[model samples]
Target: MTTPQTPGTWTRARAWLQTHPRAWDATLATAVLACMIVGSFADPGHHGGPKWGTRTPDAPSLTLMVLGAAALVLRRARPMTVLAATGALSLVELVTGDPRTPVAMCAVVALFTVAAHTDRTTTWRVALPTMTVLTAAGMLAGPLPWYAQENIAVFAWTGMAAAAGDAVRSRRDFVQAIRERAERAERTREEEARRRVAEERLRIARDLHDVVAHHIALVNVQAGVAAHVMDKRPDQAKEALAHVREASRSALNELRATVGLLRQTGDPEAPTEPAPGLHRLDELVDTFRHAGLTVEVARADHGTKLPAAVDLAAYRVIQEALTNVQKHAGSEAKAEVSVVRVGPGLEVTVLDDGPGHEGAPQDGGGHGLLGMRERVTALGGSCSAGPRPAGGFRVHAILPVQNHARQATAAEGTGNRV
Candidate 1:
């Protein structure tokens, strides 16, 4: 008759025993000692099943059983030493006890502990000898006949214990390795995500700088012109103010588009405008022209369609180069822009005819040229910007067309560079 709370109490006791390993070992040793004592009172020579309480173990057998069970308490701490102690006790009982007790059970448990804690090579080295000596002693010297089942049982039990322990060890090692690999993969994924986020931030910063710098420069120039001509030339001043308004509006629109990338997908009023590319090159040049800077454009690209990334990179290179020209070159400086296709690559060049300023923007104080190089290099292209040997600054880039775009074009049967 068990109470309802009995199972819960047993569960808690088991958990506590597991948490305290020394206590658990002591409990196991006590159990083994009881089993050995009970077996010693059983008479195997009796008819039918063995009858308990028909025989009693001598003082020597009792002493050996006690010693063997006590040694098992330290099985996990010093498995080999515990095994040696138990094996010696079992051997003594096998050689001297007239009706041998089951003292070899402790040695089996100790062998198992040794196998579980040590490597396979050491397990084998220790297990074989322990099994051989105990089995040989029991068969040859014990009161039981040489062919008795008890002697053979010693060999079988010890072998099985070693094998079971090795199996447990192998499983433990395999699980640990899997856990470590999973942890390593998770860390790699996190590192890759952080790296990508950093790159995106740098790209957005560059876009913001380009948009604000280029348009704000125009707005400043137009506002200054509007102020200078307000009294003497009302019509000219009105036109400059209109240019100022236009530049400011364009700047706002571009800023909105760039910043909208940081918005959540469900956010309202997100910009749906496509990124500016070479298709908008004319509009870009016109904006600078409206600010009173002269820019000439020449193209030999044959209207070849480009990948969106390449087109956007090409457009930004020209935009940043021209913006530097407007800022660093004298007011009367004229800029020339060229786009040409030379075998599997597109070449873009921006050259200004202004006197070479001693500290041009491309001479490394600004993020404009640095951003340009980063964008080009990211796309596997090369960019060079410096003072030209002849006169003004030169910014040139060679962007390679990726094979995938050409392959897609070929798959479509167009037979032209894409």
Candidate 2:
């Protein structure tokens, strides 16, 4: 809300004046000096007053006024120079004893210049002594009585103006500094927010890379086998083609879920657990059975309470192991899936009793091992998947309990919470 400017008067004039570069400040002093010079030319006793002042014809006082105005203009660029010019003109007024009031006006302008440009210590070094000398000398050095109240009034008002101008400049500098610091802090916050968003994008990209690369590679290999064996082994080729179709569909679905995370709007209808968790272990085991692989599930931690993330990770580990069995393990391979509750953590173990495929190349250039490692680390868990010593493959994950996972991440200086 803007405060209303006073209607058609001094306030509007002042607002416009303030917009100029130090013009309002110098304008008042210039106008007062001009009035003083004009007064010096007025009839001395025109109003029957003892001395109406400014009655003297144009001469040296006019020159002094011109010098004072020029000093006002140069105040900001060269404060000391302006002060010296005005002071010299004031001394001349003291000697001539003409243009009596305007000399005091010039001294006041000089004091303001010193206060606004120089520090307070410097202002004291120059202004205080100059004011004392000017006030004392202007009264005593002239025909005026030493006890004249008019001279004392001049000294008090001029000192007050200088002090006020210095305070205003000081306040403006301080407020400007605070505004700059606030702007910098706000920019820093925005940069930090953007960095966090970029990290999340990287994480989802890795998930898509792992899922698509592994599944599509299997589909490619199966399609090649099906095409090669189509005439001689029609039934075997049809089965391989069916597996390719299933793998491709699964890959498409996983890709969709990963891409969904990029949307800005949170899905109100989205499920809390997007991936199939360990609760679907039976369905997963049956899928492997239908894919012509023997699978056994040993549940040591069935029905145990677990966080959604831990359950999801455990389920994905088993799912990936079985999928690898179908793709890489020869048709007669047997796989074992185990879930156990260990000390402060859940351990998921997958064992395959068939030759595990090694050196599998990925389409997007990331092996499933690398993908699993990233997810496990992000969740503050440990995962190791490799070929077993006895001619098979083993994938094991030990994920902390909900409370332990939160504590572990905090201890590691990661602000991400469970």
| Best-fitting candidate, scored by TM-score | 1
Give Cα distance to truth, residue 407, candidate 2, Å.
Answer: 8.4
Q: For candidate 1, write residues 1-418 as lDDT tens digits.
A: 9757546788998999999999999999999999999988887766798988778898988999999999998988988899999999989988888777989999999999999998999999999999999999989888788888889989999999999999999999999999999999999999999999999998898888888888888888888888999999999999999988998998899899999989886787778898898999999999889888899999999998888778988999999998888888877999999999888889999999888776687564778899999999988899999887888889999998755377666867864534
Error of 2 at 305 (Å): 4.3
* lDDT, candidate 2, 1-418, per-residue tens: 9998656878778778878757875786678677767655554333565454445735677777777876777677788887778877776676566435456677677678778777778887887777777777768785456666546766786788678868977887889899999999999999999999887776676567656655775677678779989999999999888988887887787777776666566564332337657888897676567556799989888578777767766776777667776676677789998899887878888888786566332332545667676677777899987777887778888887867556656766755542
Residue 118 of model 2, lDDT score: 72
Clashing pairs in 1: none
Runs of candidate 2 with Cα error greater than 4 angstroms are 1-33, 39-63, 84-99, 110-133, 136-143, 174-178, 217-246, 263-273, 281-367, 381-400, 403-418
Off by over 4 Å in 1: 1-7, 44-48, 362-364, 403-418
TM-score of each: 0.89, 0.67
